[model samples]
Target chain A: MMRNMQRPMDAMGRDELRLWIQQLQFTMRDLALYLDTHPEDANAHRCYLDALQRWKQALAAYKERFGIQFQEQVCDHTDWSAWVSTPWPWEKGEN
Target chain B: MWQYQKALQYPVKIKQPNAKLAKMVITQLGGPDGELGASMRYLNQRYTMPLRELSGLLTDIGTEELSHMEIVSALVYQLTKGLTPEQLEAQGFAPYFVDHTTGIYPVAASGVPFSAEVFQSTGDAIADLHEDLGAEQKARKTYDNILRLADDPDVRDVIRFLRAREIVHYQRFGEGMRLLQDKLAASSPWPKNPYAFNPSFDHECWKHKGRKEK
Candidate 1:
């Protein structure tokens, strides 16, 4: 009998990892906007920090496993042109 | 300074080309309450915003509107990706096709080009925030109208997402208004008409020190 268990991030496919990173990023952005207005809300601040940390970790994992998605992560000065040469997010369904 | 991130905020993989739907959806690109106008309004208003928080709010939301503008353009591009001259002419898209030929030009359904006259930047936080709140609703209503005419599930999914964002923006602007009111009520040298004094210009009204206004 096989059970449908959730796979860990390291074992996840590229698409799954991308989706996870996107979710965490969006959570952080939404909470950032909320905290901008309601600065005194401690609960929201905590939630934002948690989301931000997760986003950073997931983004790092994606960078290490796959190619760099964000340009800020690209630290190698010799291969600076790769950032421009790589397929953009809008260029969907391309090789 | 803004950086160009080459991606849609949400993916719009349009599988079908429907010219009729494209005309209606183009309104959100350049209509009176369109994304272009929305972005310009908030970004321009922020310079005179009384509080740093409110300025940041305008900046972030305005930036998001620029992203929405790209989304609208993507929708228009995908919906009119390929078609014969006859098909375009028959589907009430001849006028637009003659002018732009599938190029994403910001224009309303009525074919009027985008103009700066659509939005206002009053420099008064109260007035500007109210306008923003109203603008969000107008954009949401336009999306609702598009949803009524749209048949494709893919198109509806993207439109639904955009509409939800309008509601979220409206909520934030409302909170901004409440913050302004509370600050006004608690501050010194209070005007007979609290709404009369422009918080952006009047230094006294901006006196919320030590993290507490009261």
Candidate 2:
């Protein structure tokens, strides 16, 4: 039940939303590694699926509000400048 | 086949520029037990793995190592950013500054460039898995050493994350080794001697016997 609780994404700021998306991404990545070795683990598989779904939603929200994080997401928008103008991950106060 | 992701796997926003710390952390990027070597080792070795699961594990872990490489590069970049030449000289970063000028070049803190000699891709599954296990411990130990010398909380926080990943990878590789052994044990004529032959190279013999059994 606790796992099912959703964060209020609409009320969150840009940085907060980005951090939430990162947490979800980390969950998905760790779960994927576990599932790779324990292919038959139903619970882990379930968690992976949930994380993936949340990650997609969070990423979409982030992209629509901020900008695309990957080249593949470029097709969703016409302005390529938004992709280039944003600060890179290594830059201070960017990521 | 890998696509570029504009964001880092983890965030790195080091406030203070410490050239000295950057020198030490650069080792994780290009040192003997660095993430670059770790990625190359697993990716290359995956080709010769006897089992699908082992190959998949290698691919996933190897991909993660690439992200780790980026994280290290970002750490080094932030650590060395915006330092004056005099400040760099005083911090013992002059040698690296002369060559790279704050550019993220893959070289050990000792100035040795990265080399393929850091890892091996033996066609033998047992040997390769052992190499991976050893590699993970070595990387973890290097992170421990960095943690010992590094004083900045910001740098250490990222280092700790990278160090923890090595432990997880070690566990996965251990599982992968066990999976390989079980498969080899079942397929071997001498069930007690799984090491009797290289499953990667002797696939024809295994296939013929497997076909006969069917």
The 0-to-1 C-alpha lDDT of every candidate, in the order given, reads: 0.80, 0.85
Error of 1 at B26 (Å): 1.4
Clashing residue pairs found in predicted model 1: none
Model 2, residue A65: what's the lDDT?
A: 79
Per-residue alpha-carbon lDDT of model 2 for B1-214, expressed as tens digits? Answer: 8876677788888989999999999999999999999999999999988888888899999999999999999999988888899999999999988988999989987999999999999898889999999999999999999999999999999999999999999999999888777666666765667676788897732543442222
Off by over 4 Å in 1: A1-7, A77-80, A92-95, B204-214
- Looking at candidate 1, what is the lDDT of residue B65? 93
lDDT of 1 by residue, A8-58 (tens): 679877777776666665666667677779989999988878777766777
Please tell me which predicted candidate would have the highest DockQ against the true structure: 2
Q: CAPRI verdict on model 1?
A: acceptable
How does candidate 1 score on lDDT?
0.80
- Report the error of model 1 at residue B25, Å: 1.1
lDDT of 1 by residue, B1-214 (tens): 9876444577777888889889999999998989999999999999998788899889989988988898888888878877788988888899999989988899998999999999999878888998999999999999998888898998999899999999998998888888877777666356345677788787777564333432
